[model samples]
Target chain A: MSEKIKILYVDDEPDNLVGFKASLRLDYQVLTAINTQQALSCLNNHQDIKVVFCDQRMPNVTGVEFFEEIRISHPLPVRILITAYTDVESIINAINKGNIFRYVKKPWLESEIIAAIDEANKFYIANSMLFIKNEELQRAYNELNKFAYSVSHDIRAPLSGILGAINFAREIDDVEEMKEMMYLMEKSLKKLDTYIISMHDYYSLQRGELKIADVDFNKLMDELKAIYTVLSKTNNVEFNVTINQNEVFRSDEVPIRLIFNNLLSNAFKYLDKTRDNRSVDVTVEVQKGIATLHVKDTGVGILGSHIGEIFNLFYRANSQEAGSGFGLYNVKSALLKLNGQIEVNSVMHQGTTFKVTIPSI
Target chain B: MKLAFIVIDDSELDCFVSRKIIEHVDKSLNVKTYQNAELAIEIIKDNPIDNSEGLTIILLDLHMPIMNGFQFVEEFEKLPIQKQKKYMIVVLSSTRNANDISRILSYNGVESMLEKPLTLEKLTSLVHRVQQGLN
Candidate 1:
């Protein structure tokens, strides 16, 4: 069995203190404090005390003042105030000052007092766990920062070489020759930029300050559609968008945009080369407080085996395809922040479809 | 005779820049550029390379509008082996993953994978290797 939690009960009257110890000692390690001085002494001695139940009224000093004085030095124990009905105003003030977790009226039932102690114990344990987790996260953040710095340096070295080559080609007045070198340089630079952006986005999502708000689905869809319109025209691809419902869905707009933009951009970029009639379809539907957005493209689709890893960071299905491969990774991270899910289906040469579902705010 | 090369990519800037790089390395080399892979593949299929003359190299871009580089490879494989042998395929992409690199290598006819906005050193090396292999 686990060691029992320690609790301290402080009162001016010896009888009340004895009554509390006799009842609570069966379930917990109870310590009795007959006055303010004795309570402070017990707190100083008992490092494992999880909670303190202090009487609001005492001869020399109030419970609030005593708890406040010791708050900085001994912070682990949760403090609860005990008071009669007449002392309600002072107890409320104590709560405001952060000295009291809760106040129990005088002549309290044994079950009520026990319940308060149990609740305080749970709070103490939860806070301790949170502190441990926060420390672990800080360590991870430091390691990631170091890695990002090294990766940036590695990427920049290659880019500088490529840039130098491009500049040299241009300086020679070799018009035809400079064109090819410029292309290669651009490719290297894009790869570097993609890597840096992906690392930054991944860390930001992990930090979990997701700003959620009500977003107009229709407006967002229209804006995205307009951006892709030019690309669709140049490629001779027909893009269609259908909104099943006009109702607004509440979610983090930024992540939602990130998910849809990546999926839609991929659809346009990888359209089927053999087919003369190329088309991409986007549909939005809201049902039962769930918003589902579907994006389908008539393109050379992903192989069944490769579909599972599409969301993985730095994973590109085909090396020949020009992409950072971070797009889908960002989409996945953003979806997680919004409490959303994505599903993909594709046939080898037919097309690919992605369905994204998000909880409506 | 010097080899004639063609670049297929969606970015006009990429095509222009890659053409310049290849030309810088080998001035006598004949190069053509296409903004889309489908158009480039169609031209390649229509104008079969003459094996008696010299080899033709196709600098293929993987991400394109109609037919991407991978789809072109799948279709290009269906061509007669004799016609395929007259041409060598090189993939130009921005992707940098081991799996993606291996997938390109898996193609039966691809000569090499070059990370894109094609650089002088990489292009020079590729041309040198091809010339050495032919000799």
Candidate 2:
């Protein structure tokens, strides 16, 4: 109902063309042509024409011939031939060849033409929907394949590390060596834990519904500070937070937390251990129903070449730390559902900053 | 026998385990670890021939960031055949990808493939095989 279904009619006789247009104009956007050439031009100009009707008798070409020719190029538009009883043999041939959808008898009634148009339009809509769904299914299949492959490696790699550490731990008796083995084992377990959590986040973000609520940035940051403060104290890294919100912002609380947690954890995880004073600065400002956040960290920054690929699923920029490669990808997915944007600026071995902006619902 | 070992893997923990297992087998053996495949390739390129009497065993992981194990083999194969023989390239990867396994094994430069978390038993037999000139 958005617009009339477009149909193209071709006939050698000008009067026939006129009659066809006059009868179908109220029901469809009727496009008429005097010959096959004009009909081809009509099809070229109006790509959206869903149905095409051609007269069987013409000067240069017959309706069946035109339909057969256009079958290769304009296959999407349903084709019907208008002919007399004498051309029944050729009509049968055309229909058998899969060139024409159906044929209409000459001196046709409006009801017959209307029936053909309705049926043809239905076929067009169904075919288009199938094509789109096919493409979506293919994309999903490819992502699922990559997801399964990466999941195996992400899960197996940590388990292998833990196994190896255990074997070494049993052979050594030095207390320092035993403690070091425990640390390594703990690190491996933590990596596995992060991978599992992000996998859960990925699943939820894909299938969960958005629950929009009034978001207070101060309270959210306070909650995050309490958790990350303990983490920062262990790593000897400074965590600073600043929040300024004069306007009420609304968004899905779960996704907002997911984004912040992933980004902040990455900030702490990738901190440059060689630096004397490593720090992560988080700034949140809300104004005019838009929340802008900046997460800057004095960590081992991303390579310029790798910045473009960092958001890709299972993409890891550096192997200096134990990472599941799902953190940034999850952040990007969450931000997409929130109608938000993120940009990263990084210099190798110096620092990295992520700037994110989300419009309130 | 004076044999040197090189462990190339992006994972720090894996590298540590490989080093430990190799040392457990032979404490006096010189074992070097590289977190980056490119850096490991640079060291191999720097040393044209095994000046030492002993052959070097390179334990390479297949799934590194910049340069993978297969890519390293491709680059190493480009070197002179004499230099290639001075060091035996052993693929120490945790990859279960069948295509990757067959493709890397097809390379003449690759001596053999081993599952990661290089166990003491595996290293012992590998060193024994190398000592007997059976690789």
Candidate 3:
């Protein structure tokens, strides 16, 4: 009781207050308040006052009125009212309307007072626990809603196109026409496949635990370059990577890879095809336990109005391009998990730049 | 002279389907395909659509590179009123989302909204409407 739980008792009579503290002092670290103002001061000074006891009859205000007033300022402390025969009605009213946790008659025995304190303490714990759990549950429900909304809209839209094509293809028997329909079916299936992959990446980032490791910037840059080289050659894309690292940086590599993956894919997807000098440049520097990665692309840039919402799931600034719209959103969450940050600078029709900074733990 | 029909969509397959459906409905309708909305807007803004010729209709896809369907519609709406009267606009989409439908339908120039694959049944009615004109 001295280490944790503290109890406060308010009474007008000095002898009764002293007697009450003397009885329960060993069981509870008890404090006596001669009036409502003194009880409020005790509550303000001591955060551990879990249960409060007040005499029903006082000079200025009744116990019910005191409980009702303190209910606003010190709502966490469970209030218990003490009354005599004449104030039984007042005690009942306090229990009903003043948020009183329990009540005991005046000249009560030690066992009865102890029982009231124990019950009020239980009520206090349960009340606080319920408040904390409700907040957590509300957050979980919001995340589930985002996942459900993305799943329905992104997956169903592609499925409808595939179904419509299959239904239309069955009626046509011409070889050339059938060949064309087969191509359409193939495109729809590929789109579905890409969407499923991004969905997997999304849920994995959301549910999977992070495992930190020392990342090799040189190897990572080489891998990225090798994978995109074929595209660079075929599409006339000018791709470059420059890395400067002097220190060992530690962080989860999956999210870093995903961040690069999404940014690189966007670089290729949104490139201005007509421009002769289309390029995507990646620059990385690691120093003082901080790694900075920048991806710059000479692509069809995003408009200023759409820059804010680009990371939102299923949001498309240029909806014509086939994108799962999960890439940037996945990148955002993954960066958050790694305690990293990302920024975007874009000017419509000119180009776009993405900057990311990550700290090693 | 054959009446011109402009089909603006990012997907080549969708353009092919739309053109095929138009051919089945009325071979006389001259169909043109643009992969980007900017080019289509340029053609409209340049007034090369030839109003004195027969009826002109635009089958616009809601999603496209450079400029999206709504942005293109906003630009097209800025064109001279006489040119707007010469052409009928209809939006084609794979989305059955009520917001997209209601929003697109709210535009005065848009004649109707059609779902994907551009079925012959939908094309027949569109062809009929083109032949009937605004009269």
TM-score of each predicted structure versus truth:
0.50, 0.91, 0.71
Q: Residue-wise lDDT of candidate 2 within A40-84, one digit each (tens)?
A: 898999999999998899987988889999999888899988988
Question: True-contact fraction for model 1?
Answer: 0.02
Candidate 2 positional error at A92, Å: 3.9
Model 1 spans > 4 angstroms off = A1-154, A170-173, A180-204, A246-248, B1-135
- Number of clashing residue pairs, candidate 2: 0
lDDT of 3 by residue, A213-274 (tens): 99989988788888888888888989999999988989888888989989998998888977
Which candidate's TM-score is highest? 2
What proportion of the true contacts does each candidate reproduce? Answer: 0.02, 0.51, 0.25
Q: Score the docking of each candidate (DockQ).
A: 0.05, 0.62, 0.26
Worst 10 residues of 1 chain A by lDDT: A152-161
Predicted candidate 2 versus true structure: per-residue lDDT over B1-135, tens digit per residue: 578899998877888888888888889989999988888888889885756577789999887777778889999998888888778899987779998899999999999999867788889999998888743
Q: Note the clash tally of each candidate.
A: 19, 0, 0
lDDT of 1 at A173: 70
In terms of lDDT, which candidate is strongest? Answer: 2
- Say which candidate scores most in DockQ: 2
Worst 10 residues of 3 chain A by lDDT: A153-162
